[model samples]
Target: MKLLKVSGILLLSSSLLFGCATMDKSTSTDKVKETKNTASEALKGVTDEYRKYAIGEIEDFVKATEAFTTAVKNGELVKAKELYGPARMYYERAEPIAEVFGDLDPKIDAREGDVPEAEWTGYHRIEKGLWMENTTKGYEQFAEQLMKDVNLLRAKVETVEVTPDILITGAVDLLNEVSTSKVTGEEDRYSHTDLYDFAANVQGAEKIYHLLNPALKKKDKELSNEIQTRFDEVYRLLNQQKNGNGYKLYTELTEAQVKELSQAVDALAEPLSQIGIVTEAS
Candidate 1:
């Protein structure tokens, strides 16, 4: 009888523990669901805002490209040179959205040798004509093609679905563009307009960061603050190289200036990379 009584008490304790465990699990699941809902809600607002900003930039880019290509078509060498860097800036600022349409991106911006010789066209082709060849003659057809490609890009961007993952990846890719090509003076190889592209890419990434900042703060306040600080540091370094309307041409930059700017970009990129984890958490 004693053994039976002990067994009964042990079974009752076991059942109570199991009941408590089940309740705990249900509460945990509810918390997980709640977090996911909050993240989704936050992303919806930011994504819409980012989409609007991208569309506006593309519209501005189309206008700038029109002015630029017209100068090339008319064989206005000086006018085209003056307009080149500024014209490309708009496209650089919203490049991630442009890159979404893989076909259009290459056709619009591909450097010489990036595509087959006959296939190569767009901005860089015109760039070499103006800077290396020292005239816009023979580029009128290329100019016309560039205008067509950009118009197509503007049209296609309207249909793009802006999502949180896109915002995250776009921000990272912009920085990567700077670190890899812009900093090395490889992107604008012929024109030496690397500064224009570098600044524009940073601005694009910064816009994405600002849009997601409020949500990021909710997830990880410390990290959000650190990223903001890094951005400020980068901008401070870049501002030192500023010239008139544009920047000091990349060819004019001293080796030390390049190293300083590269270091600042590296610092900013490291923390910026961590942002996706906070914003994308389930």
Candidate 2:
């Protein structure tokens, strides 16, 4: 029962307190007005903050992908393999926001079965070359396509709008992604980088939750507390599997460990999903 402490707990606490103080002494009518204003302001701040984070992550993803592709193109298979999982960490963190662009997301991150063989070109495509094939030959075109898609993602993030619903939905979507793919090892199948992606996805979702927490605390402190506790639990489980900043390969995880992680994610997701409903009600 070791606790895995994620960053920003103090900030969330201060935000929740600040939110409470803002509404503490108001009359019913004035409270409603203030609550609306607070929620509006919080939404705008969260949107702006998340956009900045998303853009930065995509830029990093682009750089990492470029380095990875270069290694592949230069016939440095060992370097390419070394860079593979690290490169994908950025994408996993920003995926909820990046996936907003329909065509680009698929092109950048789509798994093999997600698209036709002819159309399956992205990180996973190159992944198979490095891991399954154990060589980077014949993946030049796919590597090039991945770079284009990642750059497109960076550009598109500039124009993307972030609403409260989007933030809430993105948080939930991240968790669902873990439960559906990463936990099951469906993602990063070739390289066993699922742990890195899993951690990134959780981190991404937690970012949104932290941003919205002040407003959420005002609406339902109990629910907010529950969500936070669950997040800590999940992160604790994940932290146990970490090797430095990255995680051990998915193949290293015991069946029981995977089950524990899956259950933790499920527990977090239930309370995480309620964020949208509570926000809309406020």
Scored by TM-score, the top model is: 1
Question: lDDT scores for all predictions?
Answer: 0.83, 0.81
By summed lDDT, the worst window of 10 consecutive residues in model 2 runs over: 1-10
For model 2 the TM-score comes to 0.85
Per-residue lDDT tens digits for candidate 1, residues 70-104, read 99989899999989998888899888788889898
**What is the overall TM-score of model 1 with all chains considered together?**
0.89
Q: TM-score of each candidate? A: 0.89, 0.85
For model 2, residues 110-218, the per-residue Cα lDDT tens digits are: 8989999988998899988889989888998888878888888887888888766567678888888899889889889899989888988999989888887887898
Which portions of model 2 show Cα errors greater than 4 Å? 1-38
Whole-model alpha-carbon lDDT for candidate 2: 0.81
